[model samples]
Target: MVENALGDANSVFSSKRAALRVLVNHGEKDGLTAARMILTGIPLDETYLQNRLSIPMNDEKKSLKGGRIHIPDSYYLMGTADPTGILKSDEVCIILSFWYMHQ
Candidate 1:
């Protein structure tokens, strides 16, 4: 199993169900540094990853394709966004939160 420079714990890069992850370089954290790995659950090295960055997903069923099990809109009881620009990487970690849709 390959280790993460910052990838997921169970990401082995060889799993049949492994999904894609896009690590976008962002701001810093605790003076160490931080990046946003958009998609999650896949362990790929720099060389392997760099070659496929931003390769947009073109699947119809996002949940099935992206390792994200769909949450019915009816299940979305309520939510809140601070909107104060106070969220940080540590303060909030997005493990496959957003997804892109095309028409």
Candidate 2:
């Protein structure tokens, strides 16, 4: 990750594992705090992400022609604001608190 005098501006490009660590750690401390951080931190370019990873960025439930499993709301999507200050429909993240067992 690249760093500047201002700070780690390249955090948006950090690996998924690193991002997950931050998310999980913060979540452990506080769910709302973690959710707020993720809401403000993740800087994904919707078009680029869609074209590169073939992942939808919205909370829709429509099925993709190739597969019904590809419904827009099938997975937790990341969201962000547009230039006009409107929240993008596709940029969303789900936060849940629950227990899990490691195998």
Candidate 3:
């Protein structure tokens, strides 16, 4: 009975470890994809994007702030705030998304 219990526990641990490995790898891929979309999908120039954006905090930190764009008389674009700088417009909203390694 003891041997069987030990074997079962080991098997469960191995399975869980495999599942976690898969999740970590998927998170890395997702982070890269989000980073790409943010860089190319936005209308902003490459240089501007680099200066305005911060690097991923970790492999799981990949995110895209605004995928939706609004067009109008004045035009609305996605932007983040810099505490030390000024915002050209009076209207500013903040949004955040957290990417998890698992699910």
* TM-score of each predicted structure versus truth: 0.19, 0.20, 0.16
**Worst lDDT window (10 residues) for model 1?**
25-34
Model 1 clash pairs are: none
| Tens digits of lDDT, candidate 1, 56-91 | 112213324445433323222233565677886357
Write the residue-wise lDDT of candidate 2 on 66-86 in tens digits.
233322223344544465655
Model 3, 51-86: lDDT tens digits are: 322222222122212222112223334675667566
Clash pairs, model 3 backbone: none
**For candidate 3, what is the TM-score?**
0.16
TM-score of 1: 0.19
Query: Which stretches of model 2 miss by more than 4 angstroms?
Result: 1-12, 28-103
Model 1, C-alpha of 70: deviation from truth (Å): 7.3
Give RMSD (Å) of candidate 3 vs. truth.
Answer: 19.6
Clashes of each: 0, 8, 0
Q: Once superposed on the true structure, which residue ranges of model 1 sit more than 4 Å away at CA?
A: 1-9, 20-43, 46-74, 79-103
Deviation (Å) of 72 in candidate 2 = 35
lDDT value for model 3: 0.36
Model 2 clashing-pair count = 8
Candidate order by decreasing TM-score? 2, 1, 3
Please name the candidate that would achieve the greatest lDDT relative to the true structure: 3
Residue 42 miss distance in model 2 (angstroms): 11
